[model samples]
Each structure stands twice: as structure tokens, then as C-alpha cells.
Target: MNWKKSLRAAGLVTALTFSLVGCNTEGSYSPQEIIDHALQETKEPLTYYGEYTMDMGEAGGKAQVKEWSKDGKRRIETISENGEHNIAVNNGSQIIMYDVVKNTVHKIDISKDGLDDFPSQRDQLEILFNTVKDTHDVKIAGEEKIAGRDTYKIVAKAKKNDTLIGDIEVWVDKKTWVTLKTITNSAGNKMTTEYTKLDDSAKIDDAQFTIDIPKDAKVEEISVPESESVKLDTVKEQLGEFLMVPEENGLTLDGISLDKGIEDRSEYTFNYSKNGQQNISVTVFKANSNANKVEPVFGEKEMDIRGQKGSVMDENKFRSISWQENGYQYSIFIGNSELTIEDLVTYAKQMTIVK
Candidate 1:
């Protein structure tokens, strides 16, 4: 056997192996495949523990946070700038919050709280990738290490019709496909979020979702009044020609509800929203019996709407205009928008009775 020749051959094999491994790590993935992998949610919910820091840029201050999620349940702890601790524990059906600074425990039932299911971070990524995968140009910027794991740097840029949300860059874990960090630069403001520590395999139990309260702490239970989603026809049948929908066709009617309170008066809420960002709630009051009458709030502006006097009030960037007409009390509530009292009055005057 030729010893020198054998050593050279072994070195050549080792170099080839290293080259192939390097190629598989960086150059083997396409941007679309990376997006697809990021979009895929694991069927089995993973047990993980992580600590993260959020920099809100100039819009808000910074915060330190810790999170533990397992088996469709999670516990989150946040520390504010003033050294106050806020902790929230969600066990899928109920939520328990224990304020360390105030020593209070607040319990809320999921069904009775009137809170909608918010999309998770993964879900939001799925939505963005799905919506902009074809419209926006995406590329693999490079690879980097994040939170002690190898990640693929994916960058997607919005092309046209932009606003506060501009271009985005994300670093996703190579193995778990979880987003480890994200950077966004929009409208001259930059926001960044990254997991400073992450552990995908953690020993988490069911007891981790419950919090301990102090002996002298105050406890409060919050529950909303029962409300049902009723159809538009059902509302029109009860009260003929109800004025709920706005004249704006771009905003669609997304939520409709009837709150059966005290069995004598019914409260109807019609929610109109555009892109889930802006909303207008048209709340109509109807009396099942003839004993209830809607009264105008005192000290509000008196405006005319279809020959009826309406009370208008604007406080804390929320505007409400209420008027009694056709045996019903109609109130339009709008918040955080550019619409004014006069604009609402015109809409109210233009409201056609649905027959």
C-alpha cells in the first residue's frame, strides 16, 4: 500500500464531504420553498420556552418578555419600563392574569368575554406570505445563526400601494421553521424583534399555565353579557326598515349581533370594517315592549338628522351620534378615523330604511 497516496486520497474525500455539506445548508433552498416551509404549522404543538426583547422604535418603548407555550396553552410574562410585571396565562378555554405589582388576579371566560380568536405569529406569516408571495419579490438574502439555531434569511419587498407596512425581512429556523427574528422598515420607522433565547424542547406541564396569587390580593372575574349573531333578515323582521349598513361599499358588514338584555329590550350591534383595521358600529335599540324609551345624552351637540334632533359627542378620538327616529334609537359609534361629526350626520341623513 502507498501510504502517501492513501493520505492524500483521504484528505480529498474529507474536503469533498465538507463542500457538499456547505452546499446543502445554503445554496439548496429556494425562496418559495422556504415560504412554504414557514407556512406549514406542526400538527403537534411543540413545548417551548423563550425570552425575547421588543424594540418599538419611536412609536413606543421597549419591553422584556418571557413565554412558555405547550399543548395549545401558553403563559406570558412581560416587564415594563417602570419595573411593573404583567403576567397572563391562557389555558385554551380560560385566561388568568396575575399582576405582580398590583397583586391582583383577574379571571375571564373565553366564551363569555366577547373576545375574538387572534391569529398567532405563524398564522400572520402564513397570511402575509400567501397574500404577497406572487405580488412581492422575494429572495434568499443569506443564512445566519439566530437563537442558537441555523436560520435562512428571507426578504420580501412590497412593490406598490404601500402605507405604514412596508418591506419585511425574516429569519426562520432551519429545523423547526419557526421565525426567530424579524426586521421591518416602513415610513421612516424601523421595528425589530428577536428571540434572545429559545428552547424548542422544554419540560412543560399542565401546571405551568396556572398562577399563584397573594393571600391579600384582590380577585376579579369579568364576563360580558350574552350576545348572539342574528341574521339581517331576522332584525328586519322584528323592526321593519332598520338602518344599520353604511353607504360605503368598500366596508363590508362583518359582525352582527343581538343582545337580549332584561327580556324587555333588545340591543342590536352591526359592525362594519375595512381590512379589519377601521370599523363603524351601528347600534340600534329596539323595545320589545312599549315601556322602554331611548333618551339622548345631555350636554351633547344637537344636530338634525332626517328631521330628527340627534345628540353628538366626540371624546378621546371616539365619536358617537345618536338619534331617535321611527320608533327606534340609532347610534353610530366610530373611533380612530378621519370622519367628523358632520360626515357622520350626512351618513345618518343618507341612511335609507331597508324595506
Candidate 2:
């Protein structure tokens, strides 16, 4: 055999072997397929432990270490900030928040019925994920290298003419198909979530979702709305015309009632929900078409609540402006006068009127 001929044959064999290996190991996935796979991987309830820096608008910056666990039925979160650890354990319908600093614990029943909390947590997650999955058009935008890791970028938009969730984008890992980042926009406000140094290796304990209140700490259980005295029938009849319900369950209209109507006066009331949190208010009107700015009988105090900066009024006339802060403008103006801006906030938090 000629040595040169033999060398050429060996080279040919090597090239053929290389080609076979490439074919065997090459990944076959379209961008959309990759995104779908990634989203599926993230569907399972996960527990994550991480450090975060939050930019709270105007309240300044906050640095906290947090642990969050989601099982199909419940969620458990613990946040450490300012040398204090606050633990919140929620099972969809019930929330137990323990404030280490105050050494007090508050429990809120989110459950409509007395059921295990875990299922409630899981159900909420399912609803949120499904909203992102079904209501929007999801697509793989492209591939990019972020922080040295190859990732698939997926963008989402509300199906045509859908005004709710406007747009969203997600980044998925090429190797694991795990979502590395997500961005959501409703109207124009945007929310971005990025996962860094994620470890799927940790085994989450089921007990984390349950909290045992400390014996020495004070335990306070408060109903979300505290139930107001109002005629549900009258509120439905009066305010039903002005109220528009949200398609999303995250926000709801509730507790439409009328307080005692003053002589020659009409009082109306209503309420709304945001992310399972309730706010309500009532309006006592003199039955007069009024000015935009009404004088407060009492003084107004400055305060911030639910991410809104506003004034609080203490007065004889109780008029309310209840608003929902769900990345949109929602407000109800009820009354003929005597309530100040502060009274508006009271209405925002107290009246439960929805048709």
C-alpha cells in the first residue's frame, strides 16, 4: 500500500466520523419550539432563594434577601430587610405575614371556603401563567448571548384588539429551556423579571408554605374589607350605570350600597379589588352638581398609600374617590360636596360598589 494513499484514506474516514458526530449531537428546535419548551419547564412550582435590590418609587432603594417557594397549590415567601426578617406564607386564600421587627403576625383569609392554603396558591399561579400563555401571542424573537449564556428571546403581544396585556418578552436558555428573563407590559407600564444565578438543584420543603405563629408575638386576624353597612340592592341600582368590571379576576367590583340618604340628598357607594386586595368607599352627596375642588371642612394630611401620593381629609361630609392601581386609570367620583381629597382616599378604601 502507498503511504500517501493510506494517509488520504485515513483523512477521509476521519472526516466521515466528524460529520456523523455532528449530525448526532446537533440540536433541532425552532425558536418558538424552544420558547414553548422553556415555558413548560418553568410551569412547575419552584422555590428560589436570592438577593434583590428594589427601587421603590421615591421611597428610595431597598436591599433584601428573599426566599420564595411555589408548589402547585401554595406559595411561601420570606424576606430579610433592614436586619429584620418578614415571613409571609400564603395558601391561595389565606395569607399569614409575620413581622419580625414588630414581633407581630397578621393573618388574612383569602379563601372563600375553609380549604387548605396550598391549592389556593397553586391556583393563583395557574391563572397568572395561563393569562400570559393564552391571552397573548407568543413568538421567539431571536437568539442572543446574555451575560455569556446563549438565550432564546421570546416576545408576546395581546391578540389583536385585546387591550389588557399589551406586550411581553421572555428569554429562555438554549440548553435547559428555562426562562432566564421576562418582561410584561399592560398599557404602557412595564414589569421586568430576570433570574440570575438560578439553581434548580434545591429541593423545596412542603412545610415552608405553613407558618406557626410565635407564642409571644401578637396575632391579629383582620378581614380585608371589614364589611361595611350598605344596601347592596340600592348600590347595584344607583352606581351600576357608572361601573365597568374588569375582565381579569385580579380586579373586581364589590359592595355597592347606599348609606342613609339625607333629606333631599342622595348617597352612593362601591368598591374594587386589586391582586386579591380590596378597597372601598362611600359618598354622601347633597344632590348638587358641584365644583371640581370642594373645600374640606377639616384639615388635610399628606400620606402615601398603595403607591399613590395624596392628601387625607377629616371632615363632617364624607365623599370618596376610590381608585384601582392596576397599571391603569380607574376612579369613581361620588358625592355632591363636603368631602376633601383625603376623604377621596377613604372612599377608595372603603366603599364596595360594583354591579
Candidate 3:
């Protein structure tokens, strides 16, 4: 329970259960109907305290979480191993995160920063359900009892064998439609999160949604720079030379966006689309010369493109090829396309850095 070490893993559970309000609806519903009802029920404001456990095959941890939300305002407090307390409060406009051990607070402006929607129970569920509904096959796995409550077990299995999400099983409470337990298998590793105690009827004070930072604590402002859309010539003027257009492949330049990179560098993205449906992007950026060379991940294989050795990573949703050339790293991503590894390599071979 090193709080700092286990904070991220515990935060996932907190995000998934931030504002689950129960509904009064009754009657048997299809698995999708139940999920839809649960997603809709999250629109109401409620408070809850629960104990969550996360078990990965090799590592696992637990945390105590208390959350309160009304309207768009939210506050979540997580106490993990070593009594590490992390507090996050979103007052509709800005998000403030306090680290108790470090005695510091970080504030982020949601609108100005282009941040994703605040992690409300509704938002989290929407993202989870939408991703699975389109890519995975969903069905009812039966019924079970979780934490003394009746629940319907719903299973979502990946449609393709190469997907990162192998399978996910969720036990939805019959009365509240809240997820009591979730088991996810990805990349041959299983992780399960279960709520041992759920108190949705608890009285939450207004003070719980506000954080009282010590006067001596330091405050830091975090800003996320906006991505800049630029033309190809502008990119070449900055990075000298990189990949050019490949009109031969029926790929046309859709747009280019630039963003801040690590170590004060810049990242350039070249977006290409085919028939306005299929999209392929080539991203080029600098890497530290002394940094360890990139290695292939699971399911990646060695390949050669334009005399440069690289690796091709093939997954269910997207296919990517990455390599280092002329002191810069380049990666090409093809999303939901029928392009083969050889097809991608052919495109990679045509990339040239202008002098």
C-alpha cells in the first residue's frame, strides 16, 4: 500500500464509481437494456462510500473511496495503502487535485485545457459501454449475488482474437443497476475490481465536496497547450524534412497537427484518409540519442522498410509500424482498414526526409 505507487490503479475504481445513483425501475430487461438504464440512471446526483479491491494476476491492491456529486460538481477521496490520501474536486469549471503527502495542489482549467469530460459516473460508463458495444459481442452471462445484492452478470467478448480486450464481465445490481464487480482480461492478464461495501443512501455534507488546502501547501497551475493545425511546408521549415504525401496509395493529405513534445521537442502528425472513411496517420518526433532504443511489444514482429529495421504491431482496432531513422522516430497508424503489413511497409519505404 505505498500510496504513491498504487494511486493510479486505485483511481480507476474511483472513476468508475464516482456518481452511481440508483433507480426505482423494476422488470426484467435485456443485457443492453440494463446497461442503457444504468447509463441513464447516472444522470442523477448521489453520494456513496465503498471499499474497492483491484486484483491483477501478478499484482493487486485495495482502497477506501468516498465520493459526492451534485449537478456537475464532484469530489472524490481515495485512501490507499500507507494511508495515502488523494483528493480530487471538480467544481464544474476547473479540477483541483491535492496530494496530502506532498502538501501540494494542482489545478487544471477544463475548458481552456481541452481536457476530456470530467470523470463522472455517467461519462465513465458511456465510454466503457460505447467501446464494448461496437467492438465486442455482448450477452447475458446469468445472475449472481454480489455483496449481498442480486446482480445480473453481463459478459462482453472481443469479436476478434487479436483485440487487446479479451473479455469483460460485469455484475450489475438489480435494484440500482450499479456495477458491483467487474472482471477484465486483456493481453492474457486478468484484473478484477469488486466493491465490498456500497452505501448509496449515506448523508453527504456540502463540505465534503470542497477541499480545504493548508495555507502552507504549494499550488501549481497545469496548462495543456492546444494542438495547432499547420500545412506541410510549415512543418518542414521547423523539422527540416520528414515524410511526404503518398498520392499513389489513394491516400490524400487530410490535415496536419502539431503539438508539444517531450524534452521541449515538437511532434508533427500527418493525417491521410482514403475515400473519406479509412484514416492513416504518420507521426514524427525527436528522441533522445542516449535513450534506450525502442523494442517490439507483444504481438509485434520485426520487419524491414526502406532499409530501416522496424517492428509492426498488429492489433484488432489498429495496425502500427514504428522505426527510427535519421535520429528521429516515426510511427504510422492505420485504423479500421484492410491494409496489410506489406502495404504499410510499402508506404513507409516511400517516406523521405528532404534535405
lDDT of 3 at 149: 79
For model 3, how does the per-residue alpha-carbon lDDT over 1-355 read when each residue is reduced to its tens digit? 0111222342243335523445757777788887776777544565555566555554445566665655657777877766778899887777899999989999888866444534556667666667557678989989999878798899988887655456788888887777888887654457777777777676666676678999999999987566799987888788786665466657788888987765556888888888877567888876578855443333566788667887776654457787778777787878446876766777887876564
Angstrom error at residue 255, model 3: 2.1
lDDT for residue 10 in candidate 3, whole number 0-100: 29
Best by the lDDT measure: 3
Please identify model 2 stretches exceeding 4 Å from their true place: 1-65, 68-85, 91-93, 110-138, 143-151, 157-167, 173-179, 185-190, 210-212, 224-355
TM-score of 1: 0.58
How far is 86's C-alpha from truth in model 2 (Å)?
2.5
TM-scores for every candidate against the unseen true structure? 0.58, 0.43, 0.82
Model 3 has a clash total of 1
Q: Rank the candidates by TM-score, best first.
A: 3, 1, 2
Candidate 3, pairs of clashing residues: 1-81
Q: Per-residue alpha-carbon lDDT of model 2 for 252-354, expressed as tens digits?
A: 6555544343232345444555555553333333333342433322233445644565444322232233222432223444343444665455444543334
Q: Tens digit of lDDT per residue, candidate 1, span 141-246? A: 9999987889889898866533223567888778777677777654335667778887877888788898887899899996745678999888888887776565
Candidate 1: where is the Cα deviation over 4 Å?
1-27, 111-116, 131-135, 185-189, 224-355
